[model samples]
Structures are given as structure tokens and as C-alpha cells.
Target: MSNDNHITIYEHEILRIDRGEKRVSVNQLKALQEFYGESGVPYYSLIHNGVKFCEYVGVLQVGDTLIEILPKVDKNLTDSEASWRKVLIDMLHAVGLFNLQAPSSSNLKLNSNSILDLYFELFVKEVKYLLRQGLVKKYRKTEGNSTSLKGSLKFGKHISQNLVHQERFYIQHTVYDTTHELHAILYKVLKLLLRINTNQSIQGSLKSLELEFPEMPDLKITEATFNRLHLNRKTQGYHNAIEIARMLLLNYHPDVSKGSNHILALMFDMNLLWEQFVYVSLRKFKKGNTTITAQNTRNFWKTSKGSKSRMKPDIVLNIDKADCVVIDTKWKNIKNYNPSPEDLRQMFAYMKYYKAKKVALIYPGTDFSNSSGFYYDHDKYGAHEIGKEECSVISLPYNTDIRQWQKQIALDIYNWVEVNDESSVDC
Candidate 1:
């Protein structure tokens, strides 16, 4: 995964990817515009003679170039792309999105060019592992013209074709082999990698895998095609390879008009990733008798004669059996600005519904410190008075050591939750 064909940009960044003998070529730009036009600007918006990346942070591949979009928090922190790229990969790994193998994950996170490249390398490894195990074979029904009769015979066609000779019979027979639907899907993904993979370091491995794998018929694949595949206990080892194949196959969008400028985008929403990352971090390093649940829902509003609406918070921390803290994660830097009225109101609503004394909005804080304050209520006459419930703003620290960063987030959350402990009984 070299930087020769890779381009890294931050979130909300704009670049003029024009046609020329430059880093991003004209064909690549055309492919990108086509993808953007079809995809409706989910990753980046198509602007005037350039592209403006949105809030999504992930790898997108068009033609032979790899575009790595990352999350940007501080504008003044002059850090290398390798550093942010490592952070992005670390976050993805923490949340169980990227299943990077050992030694390569630890040893080469810095050297990896983009998320997709790392993923392609992992796929190569999985295919190699399956190769080592020797592909599984199953009994499948196939039709062929044979001199020796087997199974059911196509009598009408056999009599017409072999009328004079009357020896060869077009028969449908059962044969146990590897040319099944699973192999067909895997072969398709391998062929796709051969055409789209730009990482030169692993070109040999891809070709080797393509050669080793038995050629399978081109299939019209869909979601149901994979859902219909059946795997036995003996073939359970294909789980990982199949999972990655599912992702790649489902996300692949081929060019119908030109067919050569196809785009394979593997992008993820930063907002959802951040929420899952925070929830996973807290759950991983939580204290005793504490539980963390994500997307916990509660019915809040309902029509008189219609279905009820639910209010789902990103995270809810419970102690024993009682809800303790309602936490909301935001993938933004909340430095030098107050929380918005909408966010505060949402937190308040969560506190009221979940019966949690405190609600916190967690942000990726590279520069902000944690702060907690009480909500205000109308006093006895008409003045404003401090309320009982607490609203805290917590910012988690960042570090190259991803585990340590997760642990720090857990520590900060626990400390903030117990800042004003009322039941302080010595253990």
C-alpha cells in the first residue's frame, strides 16, 4: 500500500480534481462525477469544477486511484496523513468494522495507504487461508452429453442429436465438486479485485488466488443469491471470506453506460461510526455493575389513533437495574462554543424519559475539557433557579495508542457521572 496512487483529504475539504497528467487524472474525475451523480452526494458533493467532501470519512476507489477521506477536528494541528489515517483505522477496528489481521494491523497500520487497501490485503489473506484449507466440494446437478449413461436421460434431445450413432446421451447427473454458488461469488469478487485493486504490493497474491481458484460461471448476483447459499459444518470456515465478499458485492456499483469507469465506494458515515465507537469503548472499559446499551428506544409520543413514536438515544448507561446516565455522542469538536438549544433540549427530554439524573453529550475533544452544570428552572416567584438534574459536556482525548484512548474515554465518563456523588458510602 504505497502513497503513489493514494490521495488523502479531510472532512469538508475541497479539491480541484481536474483532467491532466496529475495525481487525479481525467478518467478518474469522470468516474467520480458519475458515481457522485448516481450516489447523490452521500460521501462528497459534486461542485463547480471540483469535489467537496462531506462529513463521511472512508475510502473510495475510482479507476486506479484510491481516495481516503478522514475526520478533521483541529485546523491548526499540523500532523501527517499517516497519523490521521492510523486514527481512522483504529476507530474502525475498535468498532468491529475492519477485521485487520494481527502483525499486519499492528505493524503496518502506519504504512497502510487507505482503508480499502488494508481491507483488500485482509481479503487476500482470508482467501489464502481458505486455499490452505482446500476448498470444499458439494454434490451439484449438472447436464452434459456422455457416452456412458448416468442419472436421468434427456430422451427427446438424445434421440434427435444422436439419431444415427445412438451412443452418446445428454444426461443430467449429480457430481460433487467445487463449482457451486459460493465459489461463483468468491470468483467474481476475486476478478473484481484484479480489475480494481491498485495496491501493487499484493498484485502477485491476487493473481495467485485467481489462478488457484477454480473458474466459475458468471452469475447474476443479488442479495437473495447469497441468502440462498447453504453451508454445512464442514464448510463453516468460509464465514470470514464470505462476510467480506458480501460487503464488497453489495456495495459494488458498476458503470452501465461506459462500463470501464466503474466505481467501488466503501464509505461510512462519521456520525454513526462515532456513536458506535463511543458505545464500544465505554462498554469495553466499563466499571463494575455497569451496563451500556446502544440505540436504546422508548415510546414517547403517539397519535390518538395511530402508532406511537419512539425516542432512541445513542447510548444509555445503567447501574444494576436503574438507568444512571443518558449519553449522546457527537462527532464534532465543541470547542469555544456553547451547546445548541436543540441538543440541550434533546438531552433534557432523554433525562426526563429515562429518569437519569444526568445527561451528557460526548464529543471528540482534541482541545476541549469536560464541563458539567445544572439546568435552570423558574424560581418561586419569577427568577431563574438551578435545577436538580445535571447536563455535562465530555470530550474524549485522542492518542495513537487506541486502547489507551478508549480507556481514557471510559475513565472520563465514569468520573463525570460520579462528580457529585450523593450516596458516598465508604467501601
Candidate 2:
């Protein structure tokens, strides 16, 4: 079994394998290379001697080692990996990935090495919560031979299969029990953690779950399975657990050939996460008749062959259902206090197409400031006057108290919008 050794690094940082440092074995490196090749190297870059981590922030377990790639948004992040890990966890909680309701953050040991243990603890708690509330029983169709006749019987199947066994009957019956897909997935996850989870604290809980959870048939999980799952008020509590299960089961890849170096990579696309985080914060803290939405799309160009190209801004704020404040989120640092030329052009295009006077680009930074400016009207002659349309390079400062930071996003946007366009709605 792989030990709980961890290699912690930030985005865009390189970790070289050597005896002087926490290094991977030859087989482990091969496994990493294999994963990189299979996943198209999106998470990290494979170099000759080491790997370069990228914008994807999460834990990747190779062999027994956990490579924790954390998000480094703040320029002044003087703290160690522990601080950033906590920040990532907090952001996840804020975005409703995992609820921080149970076993509060205060109770968790900040010194614990890998981020995986924290997630394991959360999953354990969620299952325990379900057990306490009592496992929900669902009606599942079971087809088999039984002595006692129940539901509708398949006469043909019974005659063919139960020919020698005169007392047996092959029939399709409906069973109302807790051995359903939801419990099955939870059981499967518990089984997984029981094998790979290194947290001594949760080992007993894992064993308990194994005993408590019903033995469910191995389910073939797919996106459609989750899509078809409709949670009523009674099953609403299972949402968090199901969500976590979706992440785990989907990302898991078992080593069938070797049966040892099974992989479980739970990485988040930092750009998407940042975009959703901002979008969720805006939605949560928005006050008034104003509305905020993400991925408000419009098809900009359609070819002669009817190939359509679409333009979708990350976020858009519509006021009184009148005007739009198109906002594009960049999960990057604006170190130069200047927006990229391509980005500025993108914002300009959005402004013209959306027919809005104001659009903004939001970036993560240490200081809250706006590099405000206007787009210049152009003619054949280069010299021109300022146009009425405007774009601002806005910075969202990082706060350890993520809730407060989220509220501040709305306030900042409200202040920015209302200050420029007085006709816009109030906060």
C-alpha cells in the first residue's frame, strides 16, 4: 500500500523528481505519464525529469502518494501549502461542492497532509447523516426465480428456466428496499476509501459504513443515471452525498491489470471554478431588481454552410430588464495593471454586440482597484475622440473569510455599475 506522502505545489510550479526531495518512483512516474497521456496533459505538463502543474487545482493520487495542486490567487500568499489548501476547501464549500455543515472547519486538523483526508472525512459524515435520518427505500424491479410468487410473473422465463426445478418460478418483482442506486454508490465509495484512505481517524467509520450499508448490486454509473435521479423532499438530504459520489466514481480508474496503483483524480478546472465562484457570489449577494447570470450566450456568426459560431460571456448583469453589464472573469493575475489586447478586443466586441455602455473584466488580486477607461471611436484617420462605451479592469481582492469576500463582489459591482450608469438599479 502507498503511504500518505504528499507533494504539494502551486499552479504553474514545477516539481522535479530527485532523492533530495519527495520524489516519485519509476513506476509511479510511468503512471503519471500514462494519466497525462490519457487525459491529454491538461492538468500538468510532462517534462523529461519532472512535471509542471497547471490551472487545474485538486488532489491526484498516484500509487500511494497524493500530488496536491493548490490555487494561488493572491499575489501576497506568504503562507504555506496548508493555508492554500484551506482556501481551496473554503472556496469549494462556498460554491456548494461540499457542505461544511458537519464537523465544522474548526474541528479539522489543519496540519493533516493531503487534501484527500478532508474529503474522506466529509463523505463519511454525509453517510453517517443519512444513516441517522434512516436510509431511504426505493422500488426497484428485480427479475429472478423465487418460491413465493409476487408481482407480475414472466411465464415464458419461468417455464424455460425452472423446467428441472418444479418449485422454482422465474418472475419479475418490485422490491421496496434501501439497496438502491444511491446507497449502492455510497457503498462503492466507502469501499474505495476503505482501501486507499490513509486517515486513521475515519478508518473505523469506514468499517462501520461497510457493515451498516446494504449490499447493493454493482451499478454502472453514468451521467444519465444522475440526470434521471430526481430528489424529492424525502430524498433531498442525499444531494450532497450523491454529488460527492459523482465526483469520486466518475474520476476513479481502477488498475485491473496490476490491482495496485489505482488512480482517483479529483481535480477542478480552476478557470471554470473561478467563473462559477464569481457567478455564484454575484447571484447570492445581489440585492434589488437586478439579475445576474452566467454563460448568457448569443450566436454571433453563421457560415454560408450554416456552421454557426457562438459568443458567450462568462457573466452578464441585466438591469430592470433593460441594459446589460457584460462581465468576463479571468482566473489570472493582472500584474501589469493592464488587460491583454485580445481580452480588451473580446470585451469591445461584447459591448458592441450587446449594445451596452459598460463591460468589465474581473481578476483575482491582492488589492481591490479598477483600471477604468473608454474605447476610442475609430475612422480611416487614426486620431479619434473617446467613445461613450467603457470597459474597466477590475480586481477582486482575496479574503480568507470567503463569505465576506463573496458579498463584497456584489457590492463592488453594484458600486461600479451604479456609479457609471445612474439609471441602473440600486443595491
Scored by TM-score, the top model is 1
Candidate 1 segments exceeding 4 Å error: 1-4, 17-27, 101-110, 229-232, 319-323, 378-383, 421-427
Please list the C-alpha lDDT of all candidates, in the order they appear: 0.79, 0.79
Error of 2 at 155 (Å): 5.3
True-vs-predicted CA distance for residue 51, candidate 2, Å? 1.1
**Tell me, what's the RMSD of every candidate?**
4.3, 4.4
On residues 52-140, what C-alpha lDDT tens digit does candidate 2 reach at each position? 77899998887677778889986367877677887888788778776766542224444455567777877877888888789999898
lDDT of 1 at 45: 80
Q: How much is 43 displaced in model 2, in angstroms?
A: 0.9
| lDDT agreement of model 2 with the native | 0.79
Candidate 1 residues 151-258, lDDT tens each?
A: 999888788778887778889999999988888888999999998887788789899998898999999889998898777898777776787788888888888998
Alpha-carbon TM-score of each model against the true structure: 0.90, 0.87
Clashes of each: 0, 0
TM-score of 1: 0.90
